[model samples]
Target: MVHHRPRTRERCPLWARRARASTPLRTLLLGLLLTLAAGPISMGATDGGGIGGTGITGFGPIQGFGSIFVNAREYFLRADTRITVDGRAAGRRALHVGDMVVVRGTADPARTTGWADVVQVRHPLVGRVDAVSAGGAHLTVLGQGVRIPAGVPVVGGDGHTVALHAGDWVAVSALANARDEWIATRVALRYPAGSVPAGVPAVIEGRVASVGPNGVLRIGTQAVRLEGAAAHKSAPAPGARIRVVGRYRDGVILASRLAPARPALGGPGRYVEMEGYAVPRAAGGLHSNGILLRPPGGKEGAGPTGIRADRALVFTGRIGPDGSLEIERMEPPHAPELPHAGAGGGERGFGGHGTHGIERPELERPRIERPELEQPRIERPEIGRPRIERPEIVRPEIEIPQAQRPEIPEVEMPGH
Candidate 1:
């Protein structure tokens, strides 16, 4: 679940690795010892075979058995690749499609495919913060519930762990326990109002228009590049649904994960779209235009501040339990008078406010890699990381000289 108020597109992804054991007792004992030596053990769970390779980590839905598509890159699994469910060892066959997973591995130089040692069931959500509990332990995004344990990295656009308020967009990966409750990690925040974000985190769900060789494709107006060996080797034609997890930097979305998408219907609900100066309570101090225009059965909060106020900004999302429109997505500003739209009014009670931006006639899309794929090179998992044994520590014995021991012998003679 991803929510956005306004601004941006596309991003990148990095991943992690895994290892398994044929010896169950060895695996367990190693895990226990490592836990005692280290700390709490989490996914990729029990800690054995932590030798060599790049420690790549990423989170998203599983594309298939052979890969975990994270953002634009794919993480390939090796014969020794390991699997874990909430920190416990698992069989490779334990996972399925549509199940969200967080992968840790070592990536190749090409930045596409690499060896993954660990994969776990942990779904991530990127969306507006509908509400936060008093202590901030529990929060809601769109409508999905999330629990933030201690030390979870909560970042803001300016790169700080500022207090999260309602309507702030965030991207967080979560693990569900036996009770199906969510535990969050890798939490990121949207750039604050009026600040240019260095890295824009995003999740895109749409149909792939084309899949070039080397795992690149076009989705909506954005170009997505994939990395991994043997992942969706066949080209993706138009209408091949895909879901992307990545960051939007410069203009490209470097994917960290990828998965197939099934058509979903938003059940019967009241929806609204708005374009205006999303004046929040703080930005304008109380003069802000918060909740500008809400219908009787609708809810309204300030639109995301990421959008420039100089133009017509549009926001669309569903209403949450608190009656606030949990913004699910935003778009680049467009002309006011679209087909079926009015001069200053709206078709479905949406109100277009403020004059359009004065600057440019068109915002150019970023040039992205649309190259053909090379036959993916599948290297052995232990390619770069070698199992070098640690040298043992030894101490040499020192002999005491007779002269040095003489003073103690003389004192002993006096005592005798």
Candidate 2:
């Protein structure tokens, strides 16, 4: 027979000969090693994860322009990208650096670059300044207390860093600490870059404290009037956060636009990444940027202990079907250092959001002591000068001719 004999191990390739000589366990181990080497590649393609993956959403301050950067991801704004400011449709020009924004988009598997589908800029507080602290480091606006940490950029209508004052209408972009105190990142005056424009509307965003049946909604201490709104259809319930854009007249705002506030986290099932101060909830889990976070394997209503409140944290997760965040991974906490007074100027004002590294200064209040003193007893001068009896001098009266009194006209100032 001309059939070739089975190939002998000696004549076979070196790889075949070695495979024939290897034990079953060694062969299994070799196959496992190869699979492990290629695992990342196959997994990356299927799950869009593992070394490289898509970025779905992010929330943070806009780091720079060109294409908005948030949470360390650059989201390029395309022609169809929808942009909004304070719940009103706006152009990209309305966006500025240091503005806290939520970006929703699709990123390449590498996660280096992304295309933004929606960019929303929502200010934390927008209302008339109720009060400014003595040093301008703290303010009360629309019934909410705001702290202007040193180095936080305070800008005026002219777009320059300036001191905030009482009664000044402002838009505040900020972060909420665990104490529910707002730490302002940017405070911009809303009036008069030099002069107030006619019919310009003011914007207010806050939780609706109460909703009246008479079409009046109160957010903080300010009342909003919704004209032509159905009781159940357009009115937001109490405790619902919302944005109102309108003119402020008397003590009520005539809302021209009203809508539910956009949250930092996007729709359900959306993958999201955000950097924010974590505030543990009373019920359970952690809350950040308006989203509740439940750690992996955590059961509902079962709180995670040892969670630090107001500690800045970067979280990666997906939005649950109920809108809560399902945390897949949480990085170590990163707290933003409290700003201290810089050496540049004695007066602290908004410094243009430069984000200079500042050390937290020792906040010791120096004690001042006042020396108690006794009032000196001074005896009334006994020598009251004898009142010289001055003889009453007769006064002469004169009559003047009347030129017809010129009529003064009352001028009415223009109303806003």
Each candidate: RMSD to true structure?
34.4, 32.1
- TM agreement with the true structure for every prediction: 0.25, 0.62
Candidate 1 lands at a TM-score of 0.25
lDDT by residue (tens digit), candidate 2, 98-165: 68788877765345456788898878777678889959889887777888767666876555678777
Which window of 10 residues has the lowest lDDT sum in candidate 1? Answer: 348-357
lDDT of each: 0.48, 0.67
Which whole-number lDDT from 0 to 100 does residue 139 have in model 1? 77
State residue 216's C-alpha deviation in candidate 2, in Å. Answer: 2.3
